[model samples]
Structures are given as C-alpha cells and as structure tokens.
Target: MATSNGFGPRALRYLESARNLVGCAGGAVGLGLHFAGLGGVWWPGVVAGLYGVGALLTPAPKPRPPLPPRPEPRPEPQPLPPEVSAPPAPKPEPVPAPEPAPAPDPELVALAAYLDTVPLPPSAGVDGLLAALRAAGPGPVAERIVRHRLPVAVAGYLRARTWQPWAGPDDPDPAVQLGREVDRLAGELA
Candidate 1:
C-alpha cells in the first residue's frame, strides 16, 4: 500500500541501489588515494565526500494531496397530486360564519324539560323513543332527534348512567332512548 509517511517499494529499491554504488565508488577512490601516498585519514574524507554526493542524489518523496470534499445531498422535492395543490379549498369559506346559531325555540325547551322529568331507561331503542316523542307533540323534533341525536345520546347515556335499566339482549328500551335523544337534539336547538 502507498503511504504518505515515506517512499514505497520502487523508491526504496532505487535508494538501496544508489547507496551501494556510492559505497563501492568510495572504496575504490580510498584505495587509489592510499596507493598515491594519501594517508588513512584522507581515505575517510573520500568516503565522507561520496556519502554527501549520495545524499544529494536521493530524490525527496512527494507530498500526498488532501482528500476531496464530500458532496452535499440535495433534498428531493415530492410531486404533489393536483387535488392536494389546489390552495386548500379556500378554508371552506369560513363556514358561512355559522349564522350565529339560532336561539333555542321555547317549545323545544318545554319539550326537553318534560322529557328530563320522565323516568326512562338508558338503552331504549330508537323506535319506542320516537313513539313517545310523537305522543308528546314533538313529532318534527322527534324525527330530527331520531335522525341525528338519538343514537349518539343513547350510546352516551348508556355509558354514563349508573342504572342498568331496560338494556336487553334482543332489543334496547325505546322510551329511555327517546328521552336521551330529545336531550341531545335540544342541546343543538339551544
């Protein structure tokens, strides 16, 4: 593996060969100088000189470059369907300002009061409640309550009432369901 710290195999081999050649030349020069009346001290100087030349000839290892910068990840824009992009339906026109919710009718109040006084079962079926409401002259309110409130109120009252009256396996008690239903519809009228 290539390393930043030093030369690899090829550079090492070249350096080794160059060092050996320089040492051989130094030995040859020292032998020649000794034969030519140069002393042992002169031979050491020749070897030192050859070593200096070898040091200069050896190449410097190149510096490794820094790693490249990492690329930034782009956020993927989701494609919205046409229906989702249609400006949120203009917030439903502010629900027509709710028309101020009409005040509860006096007749509805009296009817609701009357129903509250009556003792009725929590699990009364919707039909029997409608029948009782019809007998009480709230035929229209009875119809409305049965349509919207009866089922919801009966379910709620059955949940809250301590008395487990009139709820049966076959059929729920209609009279009590009618009373609870009337109470719920009256709340809307209020």
Candidate 2:
C-alpha cells in the first residue's frame, strides 16, 4: 500500500535499508548541482543533515518474533513384556595421557622468536636451524650456531629494524646476510 507520500511500503523499506548510503549520494549530487548554479552553497550540507535527521526520526524496524520450534514426532511406547530387560551399555575406553614434549634449547627458542618477528622467509629462519642440527648432530656446529651465528642474526635483525649510524654504507641487507649466514651454517654442519 502506498503511504500518503505515494511510496509503497516495499519502496520505503528499500530506502530505509541503506539510509546512510542514500544520504551521502544525495549530498554529493546536491553539491554538484550547487556548483552548477542550481542551489545555495548550503544545499549539500542541508541535504546530508536532512537525511541524518530523517534517519534519526524514523522508527526502528520491528524485530520479528522467533519461529516456534517444531515438535519432534515421538514413537508411541509399546508395553514391555514382564520378562524382558534392556542390556547394560558397554564401559568407555580410557584415553591415554599425552606425552610431554622435550624442552626446547634456550638459544633455539630465542632465535625462533626473533625470526618469527622478522620478515625473513622460512628456509632462512628456524628451518635452517633445524636443518643444521640434523646435519651436524649438534656437536661443534650447534655450538657455533648457538653461540655465534644466532646472536649475530638476531643483532642484525634488530639493527635492520632501527636506524644504524655505524653500519657501513656497503653492508648487505640484513635479511640477505641472515639467509647467507644460515646457509653457510647448514653447509658447514653438513
């Protein structure tokens, strides 16, 4: 049914659905028209303000009541014979306790954390560390990486993040240098 204004209920609802978008578009159009000598300089603002006011003045849409849940059709109970009994349910199997993981090496953990914060690719980061450990069996090579390479990589990463006054102008990008160092460590370990 059309209102006193001639807009049907559906048309009103459609407009109401996106009042803000309509208002902004109206404001833009009004501004363009004003510039083309159609209305006063206040036309755009008025158009936008009128929309806002209309939005505020309009009644909120009424929420529809929830649908009633469908009643499940239950089977009618039959009379049980006097002698029959229901079987007892089987007991559930007990779940085994999960084994705890070994504590990670402190240096490895620290290096992984730093790597995670930086933009270095996976192969240049923790994967490299794991690869080196696998190749070298964690003897001298692990010591060198843990004591030297990791610290240098972490320091380089930190330096890359901040302005470096002392860094030589010719130094390679930190990420490249870090990747190189990891590759070298893996090779040496291998």
Return the top candidate by lDDT: 2
Which portions of model 2 show Cα errors greater than 4 Å?
Answer: 1-106, 122-126, 134-136, 164-171
Query: Candidate 1 on 1-190: residue-level lDDT in tens?
Result: 7666565776766656755566567667766777787756677777667666765575655668999999999899887888776565545554455556445445545545554665555454333444455455435655566454654565565564544464556555455555655655555444
- Evaluate all candidate structures by whole-model CA lDDT and list the values in order: 0.58, 0.67
lDDT of candidate 2 over 1-190, digit per residue (tens): 6457555766777665755555556667666777888778777576677567655665666789999999999999996776785766799999998986645566666665765676655545657666556445446768787778767776876677565456688866666767787777767767
Global Cα RMSD, each model: 25.7, 12.4
Model 2 RMSD vs true structure: 12.4
Q: How does model 1 score by TM-score? A: 0.22
